[model samples]
Target: MDRKKNISMAVIKRIPKYYRYLKELAENDVDRISSNELSEKIGFTASQIRQDLNCFGDFGQQGYGYNVKELLAQISSILGLDKEYNTIIIGAGNIGQAIANYTYFQRMSFDLKAIFDINPKLIGLRIRDVSIEDIDNLESFIKNNEVDIAIICVPKERAQGVCDIITSSGIKAIWNFAPVDLKVPNDVIVENVHLSESLMTLSYLLNESKITE
Candidate 1:
């Protein structure tokens, strides 16, 4: 999706949270909801929600607020959740296996097509019903399959090389779990998930409070 120059990255990041909140509202049988109510529940200002959705065109009515199900459907379309993605996982380590087992990914339209690893023992082993293939056939496998995304769970040492291989193998996007930063072409999107950094930040926040106390 070509990002509009008008919308900031911060607003884009908040879309998922809004989607989650809307899903919760739907679960509670909410038919319609006001921006004020959303603001209180979502922790974002009503105007901010208005501003973000306005960028995609008018979704909310003046008096009616917004239809909960319709609004969620709109948000899902905006975030490309409506599109089906054929994804593969690189590396069959703990992180890779866990990601492969995440049913949430499939529910979100990211269907795992296969898992690849260099380890001989892991190769041909099935995790969550998807068999891990040899890394040697990774490129060729992508070439034949309708692979849209690659989940990188390899070690930092292998990440860059894997990035280059996958990006060149016709994958559209990368969800990198490796700690090392990866470089890719302008066309390929990369989302680096640094678990340890996030954990350390949480640790620091907790320790800072303890130290002050």
Candidate 2:
């Protein structure tokens, strides 16, 4: 399917939810489902689901709905899950270690090649058989290896410095876990996962609900 240019981020974000639900349906041996049925399960209105999917291409039939496995495969391809990404985490601290231990990323084709840290104690320590290397080796490692994405799990203070090292070493994509955002060249893409901000959002929602109650 030919992807249309300038798809809105809101629609892009919802695509993953579609993929997840479709994957679950596929796993359960579901053959086909109407958009309304999918809407009930995913909490999106049927019209909204159809519009979001139409951003990519025509999907599902008027009467028959979508073929579960086929739709899952299509969404997977759209999300680039079909390709493998060699990823490295800079900062073998708690967040870093947890990410390294998550095998689901590997199943999604994000291979954790190495982990880097400034701490000498963490260096040489292995998480899931991938040894944590010294921060000093980071540049050379990226230079020698085909590292596609750099995962920044370092402190906010050091996040930019590590990002600079990664970008200067010719890496274009970053999965930043640091609270602070990193400035990058126009060609580079940074996806930030700020844990504290997410927690704060949940806290705000919880308090808002309590006030309403």
Candidate 3:
């Protein structure tokens, strides 16, 4: 497989959607699908689908289309779902608890190894069999464990502090839920899930639709 590097972020973002739709096709026992057929199901233009996939490698044949099962496996590997990631949540608040309770992440190979919080009452509590530890133990725990991702769900005011500890401990990736933007070394990757911003974006789209109508 001839894979290209520095692929645009727009294409990278669409890869997960392709993986999801391809998984559905595979689950239904669909053996093959042309770009146009996948386009109809996935809401992307056939040419766009072809172009996006070409960034990775030549996946489809001229007449044979794409093998559903094979494509799904390739996309899965592309998304790094083929490997296990040990994850720790740095806050045991509502968002943190909700994330911990979600078992689907484990299904995708993101293992929740621990949860940390400064709250005395939340300490020693377990969510999905993972005990919540005191924040003071965060650095030591990371040192002892091979943590691949750190989730920052602490309040905005404390998010950066928690992030500093995580990055300092050599964690390369972070899934941040705090509203504030975090600064980190260039090598560290942060994916922010700002709920309020998402809601406001929805609100804007709703108003725009009303105006257009």
Candidate 4:
């Protein structure tokens, strides 16, 4: 989809936010929301919201504004939430366990197929009904199973090595939680979640807000 490729990453990032807010609205029994109302809730201009949504296709009608549930479903499909993606988490540490235990991932269509770790104590253990496999069997498991994604929750020192192994095993996408930037081939896609960097940005914003006030 050349249209998808041409879309700005900022706009792409906002799609999840839109889905989340629409979910919240759905929960609150909001059946419909005008662009102006949506702007108030999401803090983006009505024009901007329309522009973002229009990038895909026209879903809004002249008089109906937007159907809340239908629009949510549309955004869900656009974000690839309509199909289930089987994923394996590569670490069983604190962060990894939290992700493993989170049922939200399942709701978002990311099925936790398995977990992998090098620690002898963790291997064969179960987290949220998914068994932890030894890292040694990772490649075999991946080959035998329909694994769509790999999550790297290892430490910085171990992150690159784990990433290399997983990528070499034919994994196309990786969600890396480790605090390191990984080098991957052109065919591989890596989304690094740098919690510290995000927190630092928040800190800077808070300080700036206080100064402005």
Measured against the true structure, the TM-scores of the candidates, in listed sequence, are 0.94, 0.97, 0.98, 0.92
Higher-scoring candidate on TM-score, 2 or 3: 3
Tens-place lDDT digits, model 4, residues 1-213: 223448888999998888989999999999998888899999999999999988877777776788899999888888888899999999899899999999988878899999999999999999978999999999898888888999999889999998888888889999999999999989999998999999999999999999999
Off by over 4 Å in 3: none
Candidate 4 stretches with Cα past 4 Å from truth are 1-5, 206-213
Q: How close to the true structure is residue 94 of candidate 4, measured as C-alpha lDDT?
A: 89
Which parts of model 2 have CA positions greater than 4 angstroms off? none
Task: Indicate the worst ten consecutive residues by lDDT in candidate 4.
Answer: 1-10
Leading candidate by TM-score? 3
Name the 10 consecutive residues with the lowest summed lDDT in model 3.
Answer: 160-169
lDDT against the true structure, each candidate: 0.91, 0.93, 0.95, 0.90
Q: What ranges in model 1 sit over 4 Å off?
A: 1-6
> Any idea what lDDT model 1 has?
0.91
Model 2: per-residue Cα lDDT over 1-213, one tens digit each: 867889998998899999999999999999999999999999999999999888888888889999999889889999999899999999988999999999999989999999999999989999998999999999999999999999999999999998998999999999999999799999999998988999999999999999999
Q: Is candidate 3 or candidate 4 better by lDDT?
A: 3
For 125-179, candidate 3 gives per-residue lDDT tens digits of: 9998899999999999999999999999999999999999889999999999999
Residue 166 of candidate 3: its Cα lDDT? 88
Lowest lDDT 10-residue stretch of candidate 1: 1-10
